[model samples]
Target: MIVKRPVSKSLARAFFCIVLLSLLSTGVALLTLASSLRDAEAVNIAGSLRMQSYRLGYDLQANDPQLALHRQQYGRTLDSPVFQQLHHRWVPMQVQESYALLHDRWRQMDACLARGDIIWYRQNIASYVAQIDSFVLALQHYAERKMLLVVAICLLGFGAILLLVFFTLRRINQQVVAPLSALVEASRRIEQGRFDHPPLETRLTNELGLLGRTFTRMSGELEKLYRSLEESVAEKTLSLQEANRMLEVLFHCSQALNVGTIDRRCFRHILQLVREHEPVSSVEMAVGATWRLQEGEALADAPWQTLPITMQETRFGELRWQGETADKPSPQLMQSVANMLGRGLYFNQAQKHTQQLLLMEERATIARELHDSLAQVLSYLRIQLTLLRRAVPEENRAAQGIIGDFTRALNDAYQQLRELLTTFRLTLQQADFPAALEEMIEPLRAQTAATIQLDCRLSLLALDAQQQVHLLQIIREAVLNAIKHADAQEISVSCVSAPEGHHAVYIHDDGCGIESVNEPEGHYGLTIMRERAERLGGALTISRQRNGGTLVSVSFTTLSGEQTAGRPDNNNDDND
Candidate 1:
């Protein structure tokens, strides 16, 4: 069982009281001693006077015969002279009378002794001596009484001082030492983590009680703070753990998406992964102008049109999704899905076009056979007709006219076949991106009379062939839209490396600001630009410049040197 201690304030107050009481007691003792000393001095002075009076009477008796006789004669008349003066001034009235009689008797004896009267001298001398002895006895008694009184007072003062000291010590122990000891114990308990115990309660309504109350309040506050701090730390630790788990999940998802080839299957897998980790309702793929999901069969509540999908100039499809609930997806999750879809589309387009190329190659071979054999035979027939026209020439005007018309018809047939062959050869091929961009802008410059400048700062060798192609396509569409729709006087196309370690293409057109158009049309040009950028794992942004112009920008990561070979196919006919 441990006991709490009292506060320091109580001890300090008790000590102050002790010191005050001690000073008061000491002052009182000194005053009592001084008064006693004064009384003793007065008593001593009285005793000395009585002794002096006795000595004077004796001297007068033993003096010369003549003077002694004169003293005897006047003794009866002492009231009239020196004896009267001495009696009146030096002693009390009662003692003065007694001394006067003694003096008279002494004078009578002295006068007899001087006249040879020894008998008278003896009798008077004995009587006077007795009276003087009695007087001296009275004085001695008075002095002894005064001395006894002073001694009694001194003893009383000593006893009082001792009692005060004892009481003071007891008070100090009760108010200060005892309480302080208890306070020390309480502090020890507090140090040992026993905050449940309260401090000792001092009942004195002074500083001691105040200190006790203050200590109690402080202890309570400390306990509350400790508990609150512990709870806060626990909550923060749990929050950190949850955040770490979320980060781990995000890391796993990133790794899975970054590896492997991108395709429709991969795209679906990514959606599934997102749904498993997060919360997604449905996903849809749109290729060209066609929605992969048929009408009334979308996974989400709204129709496919409600999704953010653009149809016209879209090079490849988009995968638009929403959360199962009304909540929007996290921006981080959305960006991740966008990147995965871009890479997936790139691979899908390459595979689709590779298959298309095979079919086109077969068709081209058949067309070449037809042109080489059947067309050659037809050519020979036309040549034979030409020769026949020359042979019948001289005077057969109708025959000559017939041969010329036949030759003209055969030449027209040959021209048509050549045109068909040329169209087939040019069907799937594309020109170099920069050259293609230059070509598209030439016509824009001619039509708008705009000064269009192209700044191609990007190193073509640094970009993968596929990225280069998409970048150029995005730029061409952006420039065309700005020049035609924006109605600009000047257009600037710039391609450079983005500060964020990506390639960027920017198109600025001096035109009416974007705010001027209350509602911009969903032109295929913008859609195509977005699709091309997305397909290359890039982003496209459009904004009205502070000045009167429209600005279009695209940014995409550049592939490393080793990964640049075998460019991804862009044979996506899905222009929607």
Candidate 2:
């Protein structure tokens, strides 16, 4: 059978006991066997001596030279190895005493026989035989005692082995087998997703104890991972729900924006939906005084977060809200709110611009009709009146005076009609300020035959359509006045950036200087140009240049155009 390593210290004790008892039993059994063998040999030698002594005595009793042969045979037997063993004194104590007595008797008998005393020889022979018989009994007794000792030792060794095995098996059951069974059961429970294992506390220095500790550590880690996995699942579920809600917002808000259904109520509904997802003290949106949506009470400068309401490249206005800071879901809602607000404002303004376009289209049609029909008739009447006044004789002063009055009235009516046509005209085809400036300067460049240089330096200039129209008209009138009144060539229309972050447009020409730069009689065009500049949130100045040219300059500030606000699209920081 194979023996496993000792489970603990107790097993070691059992093993050591078995080994010690085995060695002791082996030694004692061997000693008993040696004693028995020695006793048997000693007994055999004593018996042989007794037989040889008897033969020697009988030979001595015989007469003639044949008796010498008997004596030689007795001496030869005594010298033999079996009989010679009794001659030694180092035998067992009992055998040694018996042999000593027998030898004394035999020696006396031999002396008597040599002197031919038959009476003493016969007496010594019997005594030697008695000593030899007593030695045999003593050896027999010693062998029996050794045999008993051997049997006792064998029984003891067997008992010891049985006891050691029993104790070791019992201890193995308690320490190793039982612990391993408990661990196996715990593993089964763990496989079934039950983490509550039995406590495995031990102070033993054995393999089982170490395995128990390691298993305990493993169970703990598994429990942690299980809990963490559950938490992760819950987190992902929340994320999906949030994604779904945002999709819903995108769907509904797109409908509100796509159709021309955007208004204050729709914007407020969007803000309310966003507030349902997050917190907001107030959300205020303004689409250039046309539409405004405000919900909840607003606090002033209390860490307000600003967002842009924009669609593509067009911006409506800024949306501002103030509230407590929010988490992942809240920021996403903020972005949706921004997108909804931007689209709502964008579509609403688009509708307003559409209506304005229709109204302007109607006005253009009326102006074209007047210019094409009424204006022609007026021109023809004025010419006919001129010819008719010439046909009237100068001698009739009254008729001449009447013709002059009629001509002057017709001329006044024509001038008013022409001014009306200019007033009703709107040139808003271009969107950018720089492009509009170029378009306005193109015609003047062709008419004046002047090398008109447009030195615009700013990359971006933010101005609403109305501001651009008024600003363009001012530039146009100023350039026309410069050409007509100044008779200038080599004009430079320089639009440079001014201090305090203002944009200045300067028109300079080397032309004939005017007597007065201010409003003069019949200088109504200058007055209208100055008014147009004022409407652009700027002032105009007309002055004669030092190098003999007129300078008409207008400086103005751009509207709301700055960096991008918080990129709520990604739900970044509110202040971003």
In terms of TM-score, which candidate is strongest? 2
Model 2 per-residue lDDT tens digits across residues 183-259: 89989998988888787744445777777778888899998998898799899998888788777876766664564
The TM-score of predicted model 1 comes to 0.33
- Identify the candidate with maximal lDDT: 2
Error of 1 at 318 (Å): 18
Worst 10 residues of 2 by lDDT: 567-576
lDDT of 1 by residue, 354-429 (tens): 5445535755775687679867987898889978987895699888888888887777767656644543332233
**Reference-based lDDT, each prediction:** 0.57, 0.68
RMSD of 2: 13.7
How far is 536's C-alpha from truth in model 2 (Å)?
0.8
TM-score of each: 0.33, 0.46
